[model samples]
Target chain A: MKKHPLDDYLRVARMPHIWCPGCGLGLVVNCFLRGLLRSQLNLDKVVIVSGIGCTGRAAGYINLDSFHTTHGRAVPFATGLKVANPELEVVVISGDGDLVAIGGNHLIHAARRNTDLTVLCVNNFVYGMTGGQMGPTTPLTARTTTSRGGSVDRPFNIPHLAAASGAAYVARWTTAHVRRLEKAVTEALLKKGFSLVEIVSPCPTYYGRMNKQVTGLDQMKYFRDNSVIKSGIDPKGVGIEVNGPIVVGKFIDRG
Target chain B: MPEREYLAGEFFLSGDDACAEGAISAGCRFFAGYPITPATEIAERMSERLPEVGGNYIQMEDELGSMAAVLGASWAGTKAMTATSGPGFSLMMENIGLGIMTETPCVVVNIQRGGPSTGLPTLTGQGDMMQARWGSHGPYSIIALSPSSPQELYDLTIRAFNLSEKYRLPVLVMSEAATGHMYEKVVIPPSGEIELLARRKPTVPPEAYLPFAPDTDLVPPMANAGEGYRLHVTGLTHDERGYPAMTVEAQDRLVRRLVDKIERNKADIIALEEDGTGDAEVVICSYGVSARVSQIAVERARGEGIRVGLLRLITVWPFPDDRVRELARQVKAFVVPEINYGQIALEVERCACGLAKVVLVPHMGGRVHAPELILEAVRQAAR
Candidate 1:
């Protein structure tokens, strides 16, 4: 019957969350909560909107004004909430497949409009919720359920895309870099006008296993070993390659 | 110029403009819409009017985003709406279903144009009647109202908001291109004189609140985003506590309540304008622009002593089945005229249930049905 420190910020009853073992989603949520606490935001005025995917369920676990919206629709839905009540802080947390694939148009348009929102994109490199299919963020040569031999198609460099589409703040961090990821989320939360923090998380049950990482810990180890911290680097040069060094940083910071 | 919250005077307005004014009067503080033909005027007027009244108007990327935005605003405890036509209406179907499943209150105005696929952009079409009822791909009921004139459009736009707030679901204002484009005198009443219904707010404290727990009226009291209540809303089949429940029993309970909230409350939801149907041998059933055309035909048939009458549908969704059935028992035949081939006529046929003959006068869209065509149908039905 021990009370958890974060219980006040979470829906404890809805606990034993639906996330799988060694899933980075929990880590991402932890970082987000830490960032939320650090930002000193009025919890009463924050609303979270998410689209359909494994990451979409994050809305339900948080004890705030949360909306689990339709597929690829969180950005637009959050846009509506923010525009209607400018006093309320709106954040969108959804997976890469939800935000960059079907919702790509909304993502770019929101950034173009410079709407005030913080978007936390959990990029597991594949569609983990619907089985490991090739997604827009899947690195080149990444194997998924659909990409049997290898993903022949080029993947999107999300930070580059966000920055190009007029995002005022764009950054990327992996689940292994929990402290940096938390700090990035905090900065994104406080920043105005279309901020995006891309969390390169692991999907051990699907994407990780398919890519030979075998376990979530292995993926975390890979991220820790391979990711190079490049502050203020150009987003265009930060695209991930197959087993290549990952360049992670805050790429865009414009008012 | 100073901002004016109420235009309390008579002015010439198109149906689309009147609808925007009506929404403003009805306390709709948030509007999100995409520009589409015929219905574009509503969004334009809203964009100009909303900021004047301390409200927000967002021109979303497309109708899908518009609909989604409307739902989001409603959750924030704002009266919200969106307007679109055929192609845009098709794009809104997914979020429309979300509105239904999440029991969110908002209004959608579909100033219908011709379409199997973008059939007519500038011309009139009543082809989206059935689509309004069943377009969202679900087993839930909907509330739809049809207006034949700018005055009715204004009045019903307010009613659409009221009904949506009362039922906690999306309400459709089904206007056609003819009504949308037509200019007519619209009387804008003072703000205090207009009756507006706000969403029911929860009575209990946040600790004891259940987001989907219905009261006696089957509508849960709503709490806005900034309120102390931490609400979790989703489109999935959820329990009364608003947690996703992936069980068959959960789906049945939730779907049934979503449907029965409107079905069981039909008497309060359905509205009809019955004119001269008491002792007529032939009753012409119609709605939207076709209703006005049917009225002229009825007047003509009455002049010719054919004993024809008109039943103008103000609320089209619940279908006024009881009244239609009662009239069917006394009438020899019923003539249904609509811009589309045969949408509401099929409803009439079902309600009539072999008690009377049903005649359908169909038009394929781009233009309203000529009075002569409806008169001809009425004359044949009177025989």
Candidate 2:
């Protein structure tokens, strides 16, 4: 495979990147850059912030003034950056655990502020960094480090959470839908007020096993098979059911 | 002072009234805050006034939310601030460190009330002075100012924003609740006198900028978020590039520079008013309301034929040790008075370093230090 033409974030290009190959976070990152590139938004004004998780690696990877902050605190941190200097385009990238769990308070409040910033939540279902632990967005019936009996609690409908919390633009997509994710990201970035884009990424190393899926390719296939595309319609209109295509597209554009 | 017909603009006012208005005059376009006592007026004022000035004013869910939102606002390229009292100041401490580490310029105002924990909600006390300087959880530099009246509150509020922007650090306006709530004759500087502070923006085009690269000026020029510079800011120990660098050498250099920037530039940051130190045996030190009371007390003590002088600290953090030591040498004793049970007094003694006798005149929780009490302490120190 050719290098994707994305700029190497001058700081951390020479890794052994800590992320697993089957992980979809890198693709989400590329999509994010593409969105930035598409908008012709100046890189100097772009601030990429993240909480601790596989997604948090966005801080080190993106050639921007990245803030790799405390777990789940990216929203508030970014909120500070945005409010302090409203000219910067602040993008908060985080994982399921970082956003929905520990940073829940900041997330809702950022939405409440309608603070003209973008939050891209890379939902890999479970915690991928410290070995697969059950995450806030993981399916209740799935097995993991914290919930071996399967997560008994229901997951957050992030699109709903974003909308009800007052995000002007809200969207959900998968790594399989790269163009769609990129476009949604563009729209969210262009939208005024708080914007959120949840990318249903594959963590083949962690979440794949408990869900009985095997490889990164298989996870992409699962999303491809399960997601039904709906343009210009309410995501609430679609139902999450067994053996059904997961609805993937723009859900609300209050802006 | 040259008489000038300046921005004599008019607006309706509140105690929180003039502050938000003053913020705009100081070029504050972003205000992120949570509602809390005596300080709530600033938030209320910002919410109502900012919109009119085509600025952003957001009421965050809590003080922490308020602090974070404003930091984000600053990073996005606006002069920003947040106001709160004791507890909120505590919540804002963590992010205050982030702002310091990131070198984000902004302001925070702690309109103080009596407290160990929510001790007095709507009363005045200058107890939070020391906390304003050492509240955050790291080795970072701070600049905190105290005002005795509303006009100084108005003027210093603007100055706080200016200094924060000028230095690329968060400054504090440590307003006691009494000063914040007091109605005073504030001469809202004509537009010309009201100096506005914008971040020292990068003149370089986007591609060549290194966000944290230090210039000859000590503080680096900052670029706003979305400006395409691709800058990075982290709380972790990092290099000048602003990435999280966790190594022995990296930590050593980063911490040293953070401390050095403020330490080396202490002369530019410290400000104080020395009242009658020309011929004195007893020199009294105070700030905020205590300073106001001390000023009168020093006058009365002089009338009683005591050789007393006053050192009123305008900038409390950076501790003003050099001046304290200088004054201590010239006096037989240093009588330090404050609302807290000796926060600044202890500092005065440390700086005095036995050059003079250090005496603390303390008043705890919701009470003000009387001039007579401070005078008595000064007399005792002389004897």
Candidate 3:
């Protein structure tokens, strides 16, 4: 039997993570651990910070120095860690609702300041932990608990937001494209000055059920069949729609 | 190693500038702040000075980010702080609760300007006194210091850092615009002469370290992040292991320790300056810039053959309740004057328990209470 490469990086005692099955957050964490391992960075000096949400639990599961800060606060907290001791590699892993909703100001400003930290925003289109409310990334006209009649508000184009706000490295990949995500994560980890990887993940339990992708596998198939890899295309032109062509590629890489 | 020069003698400095020097002298190595009136100089001074001392200073996006960064830096084994005023202080309340809940040691300076919401940005106000004690959502005790002058701001800021370190909680140095912007001669002692306090580090090996477990002093030893201690810090009601328990027992154990740690140590935490309270008929109670105004009032009252005295509070929270009770028994009345409408006066009234008549001299927050106004209150209380 082959040994799991990420087993040592997980807090096995806190296993059986709370992320719902068919949820992309678990895979995101898996790719994160794999990326951390593949990058060959000093694991002891890497700190994971997460905010409130189902995706926030990624900080606790990682067997490294971690902080589970307040809702929408992981980026600023990670900023402090990175600024205080430049030697430590700070990574912020949080859900769409947490990263861009309550924490939008921090996200934009951190990118603006070009603070040396990597941010992994897990975009599941809804607030998964709080029972799938319409979040900042929810596609327009998508049915969520908060938007039962279908959302009228426009959603954010996260990759475009990152690139516009001055992130040095910006990329997007769906969890179904595991290898691509792992590779993006590794590349992001090695880049300096506010790199962000927006992983378009599945929320089969909440976001999926409301929008009719009833199972985890159904959501995975959607990603496999619909995702388009336009590596050199402008990020501003790429925004997900209901069952839309999910854009997956490295969009920006610079100092 | 070269000898460090943290102090230069007898230069006139603003309270905000003095505070930055005070922080550097106290071994504070990280500062995160946003620019707000009455407090911007602290951030300005820190930005220029922190780098020279091998410390890091960052101007955050907002007060919320500033407070969060301070907490993060503190956990990374750096004594960290942030400074802001009125509007900025309001934004920082939520994370101040996080600092208290997680028992993070940091200093938050509110060089207060008048505000309900940016009511007076450049003017002095002591309106946030009660907010400082109860601004955060939860039930918790905090240590807040009030400084009357630039010299006191310099001295008390160091004490604020020391208290934050000893108790493992966020300590507030509450300065008004009058004090923060005022220029005065501040004598900063040599680094070796100034007593500094460091948080207790875990003595046990990494495997045995429980992040929130208390010692006899009720303060748990701290482990910095990235030190390979595998520390898990959270704002949730957590157990001694720093894991979220989410049970009644966990809430009781955690919340009680947080409050009791400061409550039990009030004797050592509280500081004040007293004059003629033993033989006085009426005691004038005040803090911050108001205390300086009250000093003049007390002097005038004494010359008028009134047995008036001053009880100037240096530590406002974990307030001098015991002293208030003792004075209420002997004195006929207490005269309280503050820049606010009537904030700390209520505390005085509560602690008096109606034993001594509490006379509040209120001001609507543009400037300090005139000495004549405080003197009139003292006269009325004396009669």
Query: Considering every candidate listed, which one attains the maximal DockQ?
Result: 1
The two-chain DockQ for each candidate, comma-separated, is 0.84, 0.54, 0.80
Model 2: lDDT of residue A142: 79
Q: Each model's TM-score, in the order given?
A: 0.99, 0.87, 0.98
Q: Over 4 Å off in model 2, which ranges?
A: A1-3, A8-16, A35-47, A64-73, A76-90, A110-117, A127-134, A141-144, A147-153, A190-194, A204-250, A253-255, B1-18, B194-198, B203-205, B330-332
**Each candidate: fraction of true contacts kept?**
0.78, 0.74, 0.75
| Model 3 chain B: lowest-lDDT 10 consecutive positions | B1-10
Number of clashing pairs per prediction, in order: 0, 54, 0
Preferred candidate (lDDT higher): 2 or 3? 3
lDDT of 2 by residue, B299-346 (tens): 888888998988888888888888888887788999888888889988
- Candidate 1 lDDT over residue span B177-227, tens digit each: 999999999999877898888889999999899989998878888888889
lDDT of 3 at A80: 89
Residue B312 shift from truth in candidate 1, angstroms: 0.9
- Of 2 and 3, the candidate ranking higher by TM-score: 3
DockQ of 3: 0.80
> Per-residue lDDT for A1-255 in model 2, tens only?
455577564344435566887889778888988888898876667788888888987888777777787667788878777665666787899997999898888898788878898999998888899999987777757777788887887777787787888888888899999998999888888888999998998988877876777789888999998887775576555433322367878878883
Q: Clashing pairs in model 1? A: none
Which regions of candidate 1 deviate over 4 angstroms? B1-3
DockQ ranking from best to worst? 1, 3, 2
Q: Which ten residues in a row have the lowest lDDT in candidate 2 chain B?
A: B1-10
